[model samples]
Target: MSFFDRFKNPKTAEEKKRIRQERLLLILSGVLLGISFPPFPFPFSLLAFVAFIPFLLVIERRETLLTLNKATYLMSFVFSLITLYWVGSWQPESDPFLMAGGIALLLAYPCVMLIASTLYYLSGKIFPKKINLWFFPVYWVLTEYLLTLTDIHFPWILLGHGQVKFLAFIQAADIIGTFGLSLVVFYINVFLYKAFSNYKNNNRYSVNYLVAGVSIFLLFVVYGLIRISSIELPNRKVRVGLIQPDINPWKKWGTGSLDKMVDDYLSLSQQAVDSGAQIIFWPETALPVYLMGGNYQNEVDKIYSFLEKNKVTLLSGMPDIQYYFNKEDAPADAKFNKSTNSYYTAYNALIELTPGTRNYKRYGKMKLVPLGEHVPFSEEFSFLADIFKWGVGLGGWNIGKDTLVFKVPVENNLGKDTISVSGLICFESVFPIFVAAFVQRGAEFIAVVTNDSWYGNSSGPYQHKDFAILRAVENRRSVVRAANGGISCIINPLGEIEAETKMFTKDVLVGDVVLNKEKTFYTEHPKIVTAIISIFSLWVVGINILLFIKKKFDL
Candidate 1:
């Protein structure tokens, strides 16, 4: 029979009530889970684990033959709808319907979430009830592990992402990255689920759940204490300055506000210099015009000259546009490799200025944002350039090739150190691996330049800045973040905000913090920690397979 036919015309109202309960359980779980997204902040984060107990209990302990497939999909649907709401928030003006299509994708991806739930449920079904409790957490952790593939896999709302605000809880991030908290969150939920399911009937399960939960909580406490005590942060401070220009991008780029924008930055930088800053940083795309071009060569030289005379290292986020040709004047749509085969402008960027340096050195930003930096299918399906607004003259951005390092000789009251600095522009700071790459490549300090003006007064800037602080803590490196509309701050290697400027304010903060030459685990081997977790995940999968074989053969 068909799906609905199986449950249709139930002889008793009891059957209808059971179906209704299943639907409610799934939808509620999905919606509550979305709160686990960023902005809620942790140890308020532990609330998300509570959401899972009800949902998982309902899915695993169902008595009827009404398969969980439908409920799981609905749960996934509700989740993606709320969690990935930002995707639909940004729509191209040309096609308003594109927003709706983007929103639809959020629900469509619920299939994968449903599949994840299905695997976990299958493990519980095959194993003994007592053993299943342990496997439930393991299975869920494995599900989260596999959710890190490119394009398709979505790892956005992993439980730890919610802990962005809590420094102490997130200290674990330095050791195991965000995935560890995901496993812990689900492990707690699994124990709770069994506790609730076995309540009244056994009552014993609840005690076990409490014991396990308390144990995990204590372990995290011990972990935090150990990390804070054992890991002595090397004396790595920098005399840093952050300038917030408070310029509107639309008016600056599209209107006649160019002069005003330039004046805002120059004034901010001078103010920072007056405050005795040894290094000054400006926000992303700070320069309205190309400084290095032959036409503007004199201006670029002038900025360098001023910086040198001031004895300060000036880090500015400016776009360095370069024309690229396959041979000579190859058509704009010329192909390179299969991935990036479009002929257009490429970026020669991330320039650093030190007072008295002969010339400025630059590093182009790698790992560009999907639509904002370069259109995905523009190379394979090249028509996206002209037809759809992905052209150099308009919407498209040129990709940068190299990672820029800014070498500076920093001096303190006690002594001086030769420090190598690098920058992560805008969304580049959001990617842990990318920032870790810079640290591995001999960068002693991180300078994150972001323009959150487009994001407006939402929690966007705070959320973005919060993640940047994690990079600092994870690498034990000082981070200086310069933004267009404030939330500009200095983050120490321990993930503490040593100093911060107010949001949406025209402010310049200058302070003396050390920049060190010491090494950090996250800086040394980025993928190493994530790789160890990945291996543990594979072991969980292997155990599940072994158990399945034992069940099938009755061995």
Candidate 2:
């Protein structure tokens, strides 16, 4: 028998029925949590909220703390497992073991869930009088709010992500950020829980309860539909050429060579310019060649000349290097690296290259790709760090501490106008906070450069396309993405895909992207409000701790 079976006693039929229902809830929670991960449709998220209701209704009310704790762990485990399993599947054959190990360690969500569950459990006891029908919703909001502030945030498959497919309901994300939608989902789930619990307990239905349960929903549904339909994208003066360089990451890094890589991008960029393109963008690492000033000056000079001759400002990703210096040998606040072979640098970064112009900017990616970019803190799964066949840079990739915002002078029909745009390299598009920061820093338009060739030609690119839509909605900003190996798209603030290219195809996605100065709540200040909410939750936990301590003394 299982270990839990030994502790169990034979139950009567009534008790058996309750236990069965609880088990069903747990399984339902697991499936919903799994669906919340990508490679599935967004409408599936309604199931997550629906599933939470049964657990709240059927699980013993007194054991609410413990029951939810188990539920949290179970759901979190399923989520982390399904989401992170791509590590092993994508790993090169030689280092499959390392990929397997890294996948386990990087998945720290279960522990985070366990912590949140414990805090809420104590609140259930300490605030017993105030643990109203809204308690569960409040607790869930607190957890999500806390998750974003902490360093170990992997904001993939958020509740707001679930509405990427449903553009009408999601347009409000610009005002409240993705968290607002998440709050609504929790609100509905908690209301449903209260409804189910009340109905199951008695034969009579309370009209007061029904109104209390669904009133917010009715208001939200009405307001959401109205806002989505009423608002139209205001005209802004801006035009950009999204550079879609279809290059495979493996071949670009391997013996297959970067000759095609360099030629294809340069040729496409020239074409965009000839077609009256002002600002051109290339996908992440589209220029697979390493750029070290002076040393690779000859190679780097050619790219610079191309930009100036074409008279188009080119924002592209290349292999960027900085010198690594020992901390002891370097002065505090040193601007440049002074260690390796006459001024080598310590990091790899995404750099902005302007033709005929000496002024350029570089932004190191802040959130590195797990395993693919960097390893987790603990060495328990350190073996997983060694698995990238085409991946370079040892130890870890350098993280940019602040927002990498830049401006470029462009030639438009309106006149010689300067546009402010920020680059979100690869996975950063999925991170809402990062996107918000760039917007806050006067980035009128969001430009994302990605090399989706890592996942091959499959659902990976399609899934990423979903997030591109979310970025536009969540920030209330127009977004243009340049992807290597297809799915390059231009999305408007209203979550409309203006134009998109197909997967695994050599294609150009052309569209008119407008630049706007109209700021949304998320774009103005993304995490500042959420940070306040998270701080209040800590206070709630503190109060619960005091109650726990006082009770212990009384005993």
Candidate 3:
């Protein structure tokens, strides 16, 4: 039977009514989830609590595995579509119909959701009735952790991210990471669903589960309050200048005047320096050309000269190319050019140019944006690139291997010391584990340089900025975000937005970011939570397989 046959071939009026009700509930869940995100409709993040309740109700009502799977997919797809419509809007000129990008977005969010939902349903089938709810939350978190392991990672819409504005509630991320918060959210929805169902059936409500759920939530809030009150900004401070050039990325890509763009950035850097800025940060692709690719040495030297004359360190995003005589020596993902007769690797990198130093420290971006910066599975099927290519000259960038940290000299009232900095380019800021690894490697603070102009004036920029807050709270590190368009801001360790710029505006933001060497529980033991969950997931699978064997063989 075709996929749509179920809708058309309803045998009874009750079945038709049930299908209509399920569709409505699923869509409601999606909208509620979307509005719960940052830059919310009215800043009511508590909507997230009840957002999944409708979907849970639909799942409970499912009579078959197929129905449960369909309901889950519908809920997830609608939620992803509503909240992440900007995914399709990115680089529309390159993908006029938004097919390639749209399909990629579908795979990133909805398809992942389908997998999570399927796992959830399967886990429920394997577990006993009373303990099934617990399994779903754990399995959901496992699914989220699994996303981090893949190349096409989109950790943007994690449940903890929705609560970033509630600084007093989400500080627990420092201990257990964002997955812990997601676990809490799922438990709450399950509790509410149980309560509502019991009331409908005139049965005694599960007060024990309710108390346990409420206690967990209260603990998160109380722990957050204590942690927030105890956080101390380090004495050593770095006055960082964030430049939002407000250049339209599409237009910037097409423009020929590379010198003009470089001058624009330098002029802004000078403005920041005039205001006592010690370190200047420019957005991703601010130079638009490979600085070390040997073609733009003069322009690269011009920026270097400005940094030298002002005695300020500049951290800017630029394309970097490394040529290899042997293709075997290049990275596994490196692209080979037949015309050049050499294999080379390209990176979306953050370069640190300091005064009186010819050798600059370069940190290549590890998490390349799928379909936008790097095409997935291109190595296996190179023709997939021509089919999925969009945006002028965007795609097929090689991934970076190292978690490079740069040291910057700064002074405080106490004394002077070099601060270790972790520079995250573009979407790398969204990954909790990725940022924590840098902190574990002794990065005092985090700097995020991005080109969000591709998202235009949509909620994409706002949503992107919110992730920085979670990263700050999770790692207890100050985040300095410099976006090409707007939403540039400085986020303190407590998940507070100290300063920010409006979207689509040319602006310079200068703020003091405290340099701290303290590592939080999350940074020191990054994958502890996920690791524990993985072991339990394996145990669950093992038990299920053993039970199936026993039942099949009458053992």
The prediction achieving the highest TM-score against the true structure is 3
Predicted structure with the largest lDDT when compared to the true one: 3
Candidate 2 per-residue C-alpha lDDT over 364-459 given as tens digits, one digit per residue, 9 for 90 to 100: 777666555655431344344454322333234545567877788876656777888888888888877778888888898898888876666545
Who is ahead in lDDT, 2 or 3?
3
lDDT per residue, candidate 3, 1-555, as tens digits? 777876687889997898798899999998898888877843577888778889888876665667777887788777777678887775545456355576657655766666556665557667765566556777777777777766667787888788877888889888887888888888787887777776777767666656766777788889889988887777778899999999877777776699888888899889999988989999998877787776888887898899888888988898888898797797776677889888888888998888888888888889988877777777777788777765567676777889989888755445666879999998898888888989988998999999877766787888889878989988889999999997899999898899999988889999888778888888888788788889987877777788889989999
TM-score of 3: 0.94
Against the true structure, candidate 2 reaches a TM-score of 0.86
Candidate RMSDs in order: 4.9, 4.2, 2.5
Model 1 lDDT per residue over 1-555, tens place: 686777568778997898788788888887777766655566555566677766775666643323656666787688667656555436233234334545666766676665555555555555665675565455454455455543233454556666666666667766666666666777777766766766757776678877787688667768766776776665556677788888765455545544456556667777887887777888887865666643665566666766766777878887765544454764453434436453445452567777665566776666554554555567566676555442223245555666767787767555786768888887677666667777777888888888777645555566677777677767777888899887788887777788998878888889866566766665666576457655755665677789879989999
In candidate 2, where is summed lDDT lowest over 10 consecutive residues?
Answer: 332-341
Please identify which of the two predictions, 1 or 2, would achieve the higher TM-score against the true structure.
2
lDDT of each: 0.66, 0.66, 0.81
Q: Which residue pairs come into collision in candidate 3?
A: none
